[model samples]
Target: MTVQNILSIPPYHYVHVLDLNSNVQTLVLGPKSYVCKEHERFTCEPKRMISLSPTEYCVIRNPVVTENGVPVVDSDGQVRLRMGECEYRFHQDSFPLYPNEEMSGGVEVLPVVLADSALRLKARCDHVDTDGTERKAGDEWLFEGPGEQTGSSSHINCSSVRCTEISRSRLLQCFIDYLQFETRGIHIFAIKNLSIF
Candidate 1:
């Protein structure tokens, strides 16, 4: 992506050497500030809980670009989760996600993980199952796709006999639908729910 396209996302971080015309850097995101390569060399952070789709949960303006890093580094050298972008000689920073902010938009992922671990982990919505076979309540699904779990592609991870990846639009719609019907409990289908967990 071009530098401008990358900066489209709100809240970023950057370097702040004002005197150095050639060695200056900046970002344009949350709590954004400047870093000086000559004096205060700061790194950039991008948005973490972003509205990937143009759904209803999104509050901030869609900048058309976004970035995030796990175990992110700060200007003071502290290891924290971070997301940001660069502006004209400035850096933007975003509100970090708690260890349990996976359901940022109220829709919980049942089969995949957005991100996890001491290092870094991120999962993107792939698709949904419209023809899901109804099952009894309290069914536990073994997640084996992203996150700390892995399974052979041939082995289906959910109750569904088939696994398929859909477009981003479908993924977003599934998340929206889930938030509407799901009651934050265990269910049998393609996925399950966790308790604020």
Candidate 2:
């Protein structure tokens, strides 16, 4: 059966399968799935951002098809990723996966670079699929925008801000603010070794 036949399955996660020896490429949808909730990774409040650690990685979802200069939604009313000759379709319920395209789309995954790591602090809205699943934002489903530009001056600015201003108390407040809205799931910002000398 073709992809269209099997694509209807709700909440599909695409795993790229590649065999270097044979140069065979295939897309496998599967065992991994996610359902978002308001109080899970984030709250319903606007402008409330999440902070990410350096080790954290995020998956992004592209809301529109941008094969053309202008973006248009796919016929299936789902997300599409065109990487070379192969085009991948995803159910609207899919949380986040990086789009392998050269141009910038309306939606994007986070930590565009180490420089915009601060952008992780920006809060985003949760996605509700047609089936009524609430999709929370995380490294997988983060929507990163054109944040701090990369260059010499930006590097200096980011470094200065990190070194001079960020404090444990401030971080705690940020985490507390985030927690106020979360009703279920573990707190994303749990301070393990926080202490005073």
The per-candidate count of clashes, in order, stands at: 30, 5
- lDDT string for model 2 (71-112, tens) is 444554333554333222222333323223222233323234
Residue-level lDDT tens digits of model 1 in 1-197: 11221222334322212223433333233444333333433333344433322112221211212246344434643333322311111122323333212232342222334332111112222322233534233222334333423321122333321234465545322222132232236443433443221
- TM-score of each candidate? 0.20, 0.18
Task: Report lDDT (CA) for all predictions.
Answer: 0.29, 0.31
Pick out the ten consecutive residues of candidate 2 with the lowest summed lDDT: 152-161
| Alpha carbon deviation, residue 105, candidate 1 (Å) | 18
lDDT of 1 at 157: 34
Which candidate tops TM-score? 1
Model 2, CA-based lDDT: 0.31
Worst 10 residues of 1 by lDDT: 82-91
Clashing pairs for model 2 are: 36-134, 49-123, 58-139, 59-139, 59-140
Q: In model 1, what is the error at residue 143, expressed in angstroms?
A: 11
